[model samples]
Target chain A: MLEIKNLSARIGDKEILRGVTLSVPDGEIHAIMGPNGAGKSTLSYVLSGRDGYEVTGGEAIYNGQDILALTPEARAAAGIFLAFQYPVELPGVGNANFMRTALNAVKRARGEAELDAVAFLKLARAALKKLSMQDDMLKRNVNVGFSGGEKKRNEVLQMALLQPGLAILDETDSGLDIDALKIVAEGVNALRSETFSALVITHYQRLLDYIVPDKVHVLAAGKIVRSGGPELALELEARGYAGLEAA
Target chain B: MTALPTQRLESWRYTDLRALNAMSFAEAPAASLPDGLPDIGVPRLVFVNGRFDEAASSALPFARNFAAVDEVSDLPLARINAEHAHDGVTLEIPDGVDAGVVLLVSYANGGALHPRHRVSLGAGAALTLLEVVKGDGVYWHNPVTDIVLAQGASLAHYRLQDESQEAFHLATIRATVAADAAYESFTAVMGAKLSRAEFHVELTGAKAHTHLNAAQLLGGSQHGDFTSVVRHKAPDCSSRQTVKSVLCDSARGVFQGRIEVERVAQKTDGYQMSQALLLSPTAEMDIKPELQIYADDVKCSHGATIGALDEEQVFYLRSRGIPEDTARSMLIRAFLTEALEPVTHEGAHALFEAAIETWWARK
Candidate 1:
């Protein structure tokens, strides 16, 4: 489970997330729908402990522990995963090697035995298959030349491998085609379980059609203006947030 | 060993090796020579004090076509300051002989340790050369290496510079590549108080390929300079140069890479990139990548970046549960991976990686 309490964040001198609060329980998928500059990505970044973003107020708690004080890798070790809106390209670093290092780092933090090269390769191959990704992707540099959809799927692949307690997908549906979206959604759907939770950050309800969120929170400006059942996504998609200012 | 030459010496123009003469470099510890060296050897020629040590070196049996020398009487020494100019070793590969891993080890220490090595691969031959340079005690090391690759030959050379911090080091590597030949060189400098390395490559033949990569990690008051010049005299050759420098504390680093292409060398492709990461605010670095291309049809590009650590990446790793120091080390390790790629020997790669990690721990 993850909790955000009055999380206020800013970049430079401008405020981004102003008194935003949300929570996602185990086995639940929460959707945050907002227009451009709604602080959607900023929320994900702040949660993942990115630098240069000032957290002026409140805190984020994950799995009964304060996460705001943790480093990014610490948050990751604590089972907080963020599928970046844009996957960074690490040249000369093999994709599988990076994934394995990340997995082992988290695993070691959780008191789990580290996986060797063979075992890591097997697990990575299985995860790639589940995500409908090719095995050749394992040999290339991390996201060096990956397609946009491939990068999104790779993010899911990492999430599945790390088996994070809370996974945040930041605009993962942006560049995915219909098939790729379906595959990505299937990857997420397959990872759904009683102990898993996710925050799906997106602008449209198209992805919701496949993943099917249990709760939808409309985030405007910085705060979550409305929280409702799955039907909230459809309502927002039809009516748009143009009228939400008065609400 | 002789005393340091006066400042009037032309060779010591930019730097004064005499500054180290005042400090009494303690006697060098006895070395129990390498035990059971691997037979995975190629054509090897060893040098000590900038001169060939024949008794300590071995040559291939019935060496006919290839030219192997145990001594060179006429030394064309360049940097002769004072009366102490030492001799060096030289080796030449005959045409049409493809040699495997050629390991050249140079040991320098005490007083003035100057060694010179000359390597020439004949036409259509392929060779791999590795130069390992290190020493103990406070000493001065000034080693020079010359390599000539004839037409259609390929050469790969790697240098590992690990000297004592109390030592002053100066090394120059000059290479010439002929038509259709390929030359690759990599240098990793990890120690020394004032270590300066110069790399010069002259591409004299058409369709020759040249690549150079260097990584210099400096801490304490260590000073490292990787100055290089690559010339494209003929057309259709490709060249790539990348230098990465990491400086900590009061350490100083410099990267001056110049690439030149003559007007006749059309269709030349040359690229150069240099990046410096300063861990401490007091750490200093000077990176200058120059391109002087006379050929209008050549594609020449260069870039230099100097900055502190990437806070975003650092935080990303830290938030992943890695400690602050560990995160910085990981990023630095990743940054160095690019320079270490040319090392084909996995064991050597691991050794270099461990050295980098050890240096990071000291930071």
Candidate 2:
């Protein structure tokens, strides 16, 4: 569903994602495991269309369209969702209102009818239930004052509501405890379908235990050095990235 | 004499309307509110051109308020004159009267230059005062309000200032809170060619408290300033001030807040914060928040910040299918949301938010 062909990106004068190429087909979960400053987040951002990241070379296509040509919102409407490494805390914007706006924006792009307040609440409640989050979260500001686990779950809650075709989760498990990780992974796992795909960018194999990926890729420096089955994640966990980088 | 520009006057330099002196305003004829306002509230005093109009003023059942002095003939108008004193309204909450009051001040084009209002909250009295200032045409409006809080009195004041693009609006509010009194003021400014508001609060008695919050949203070449001073003069007094502004296009905004704690005001606590968001490259903001503490036992702190819209937040929203413009507008609205939170009246808060949305829409 998503394809990155020799995608290269840079931040100011420094090149990060140097001609990195990868593809994740529908109905499968892919993992990109890399150490810090290894351009793992850079790949996610480049695919999601973040500012200050210049794509010096190559192309990224989603659903047969050049993703680079579309604005971040357009990409999202085209079914691209990026769960930020650190979710923003919008102090006054209610979570429900935010989800409704985003859902409607995507629907509008797809020529679908917008959901009214009643319909939105009904759908949102079901999604929140899947994430095991309380209804109070809807009334509260978007992620404001939420614990790290809560913010991560909020991101998944948004993903569940948006129902995007492809989701790029960048370090969503970083601050999550084991139990919280299970719930988050369960939320993502439940969304897995014949038409849904995801790029799970993480450093630990613990998250892989929850939402097992169909394939694992080792991203070192600016390129993917190796690709293997979910068992590769175990191998990398047993033998740290330091050993693999020198291999 | 030209007003002292001590970061006080020409602070409007970037978007100065002082050149507006060349334009003349025609006086509005005797007029009253046309319709659709509830009359069940407490007493109200309506004035035009710093003069009271008894015939048009409303005196409801629960309404038992009006200056015992009838006219504030001896009130200070040192810097105000007939040349600038166009029209005004005043309301006084009598002793022991604990009710709510609403004052609607509407001005038309060619109206007077200055409209003044004076309000006094009697001891043991509590009141929620809603003041709405609106204008129709391109004119100059200078408004000044003076408030006095007696011992044990409390006031919840909401000031809505929305004028026209062609109008130059300037206003000042000076309030004094006596011992044990409390003052809570929220001012929202969303319109006008050149608008500036000065808020000065004096905590004069032990245990007195003052809270000031302001939100200003300006678009086009509109200009606005929210300058405030909170002085704690008595021991154990407390004060807090927060101001937020959003500017778009070539618009400009300024926030200068100062909190002072006197030496005698031991155990005093003062805090102030000013934040501004520039939505456009040409948009500019000046924020200066200061704290002067003379009491070694007092706690005082002040902070100011001016920044452009958060590009990261914008991208995050856009990546979710919200257009860039919509994302930026949402962030701007969020930036000012904190300052508007203290407004407990849902309807009033909605009206102010609507004003912000309209400003963004017009942009």
Listed per prediction, chain B TM-scores read 0.83, 0.84
Fnat measured on candidate 1: 0.45
Runs with alpha carbons beyond 4 Å of true place in candidate 2:
A238-247, B1-17, B23-78, B82-87, B290-296
Q: How many clashing residue pairs, candidate 1?
A: 22
Q: Candidate 1 lDDT (Cα, whole model)?
A: 0.78
List RMSD in Å for every model shown. Answer: 4.3, 3.9
* Candidate 1 structure quality by residue, lDDT tens digits, A129-177: 8887899989987777899988888778887888887889998999899
Instruction: Please identify model 1 stretches exceeding 4 Å from their true place.
Output: A12-15, A243-246, B1-77, B81-87, B233-238, B260-269, B290-297, B315-327, B337-342, B345-351
Q: Scoring each candidate complex against the real one, what DockQ results? A: 0.43, 0.70
What TM-score, computed on C-alpha atoms, does each candidate reach?
0.86, 0.87
lDDT of model 1, residue B232: 96
* lDDT of candidate 2 over B1-363, digit per residue (tens): 224233334433433544565755445455555453323344545444334556656654433332322223222221532335544555577788886656554544455555656678889888777776665666666666778999999988888787767777777788999999998889988878887787878999999998899888888888888878788899998887778887778888888787888889999988788888877899988877667888899888788888887677788788888888888878888888778766776666776777678777876
